[model samples]
Target: MGREFIDLFDKWATSYDAAVTGHDPQYRDVFENYDTILSEVVSNSEGNVLEFGVGTGNLSKKLLDADHHVIGIEPSKAMREAASAKYPDLTVLDGDFLSFPKLDIPIFTIVSTYAFHHLTDDEKGKAIKAFNEILPVNGKVVFADTVFESEETKQEIIDQAKDNGYNDLVYDLTTEYYPMKNTLQSLFKQNGFYVTFKQMNKFAWLIVAEKQ
Candidate 1:
């Protein structure tokens, strides 16, 4: 992400939590499903966690409440500050996933929710390799994001939106880029992780990759 992007998020930091979760049923479902997946993963692991794009500490708060130590890496200063204020005890860092300094500590699990789609395909590949370097052999990377499975699916969604009379649906979808699930799974496997994907809904996906 660039400085301009960070600035945009900084401006939205305060309202992000409610803006994302309050109005849309799909957005709320993303949160609910992510909570369940994150909880299940944390419950099965004993090691520390590093959460990328830990916006407003929504998921981090849940991990902390479960007694899991989490280090949150966020690029936007305002977002980081907001997360820090919400969970004073949690460690929140200011950096993007691709450029963040590698940590010295062992990461049992690295997770991102509703965040990874901000990256382009090449950037996502670099992120996968970076995570591979920092994690143990058995460590896992859990990613949950809004995505389309293929071009056909994306087009179907576009058609549905138009038929349903959503004026801005096509414009909105065209502006933001989301990785195809198969592309991400291929990236994970190529980087030496065993990957499993779960479709949370028509446009949401959760991928759990364990180092092989």
Candidate 2:
């Protein structure tokens, strides 16, 4: 089901930005504060960064501007094409987050924005484990995604979605997949990373984890 969503995104890649602009303001914050979030985890001299789901080169441009050498892994061919066209020098690969080809180079930081939620529970665990295996000691993993505070809030989000004509957005079995603070911290800890989370809004969280 999630793979189908990825395929849809691939097809929508050409007009992805335009289709999303103003239609979903929640995602806009993720793009807007991307630089600030990256700066929090990466030092000026941080080298060899990897970005998952580098859709349309939105966050890739910011990482490149920060002087970090970036390699982006994206599953969608259309999205990757858009990114390649926009940033011709970028190293963008068409791959899934769970099975992205590992680079032999030592990684300093790994960043993913709005991409984690697309993973299933098992996939999330595998992805985090893979991240831990690839990242060097003290390397960082920063992820930002939508999170629900409580069951009520989660229901509210679903209700809002239905109201907004997104009744077909029920791919996940439970909305609880969007982890709360404690759940996210525990997941990171279980994956051998020390975690810190900042509430970006009522429905969004920015989490930074350092390899242990």
Pick the TM-score winner. Answer: 1
lDDT per residue for candidate 1 within 1-212, as digits (tens), equals 43336765786697677655545442343345555655654554447888888888887888888777788889988888898898899888878878776686778888887778778788888889988988889899987777777888888877877676664545546655688878988989999999988776566677789999
Clashing pairs in 2: none
> Every model's Cα RMSD, please?
2.6, 3.3
Candidates in order have lDDT scores of 0.76, 0.71
Q: lDDT (0-100) at residue 178 of candidate 1?
A: 81
Q: Which has the greatest lDDT?
A: 1
For model 2, state the Cα shift of residue 134 in Å. 1.0
Q: How do the predictions measure up, each by TM-score?
A: 0.86, 0.83
TM-score of 2: 0.83
Could you tell me which residue pairs clash in candidate 1? Answer: none
Q: Write the per-residue lDDT of candidate 2 for residues 72-181, one digit (tens) a residue.
A: 99888888889999999899987777777768678888887666777766677788888898888888888777766666777776766566655434433144256556
| Model 2 lDDT-worst window of ten | 167-176
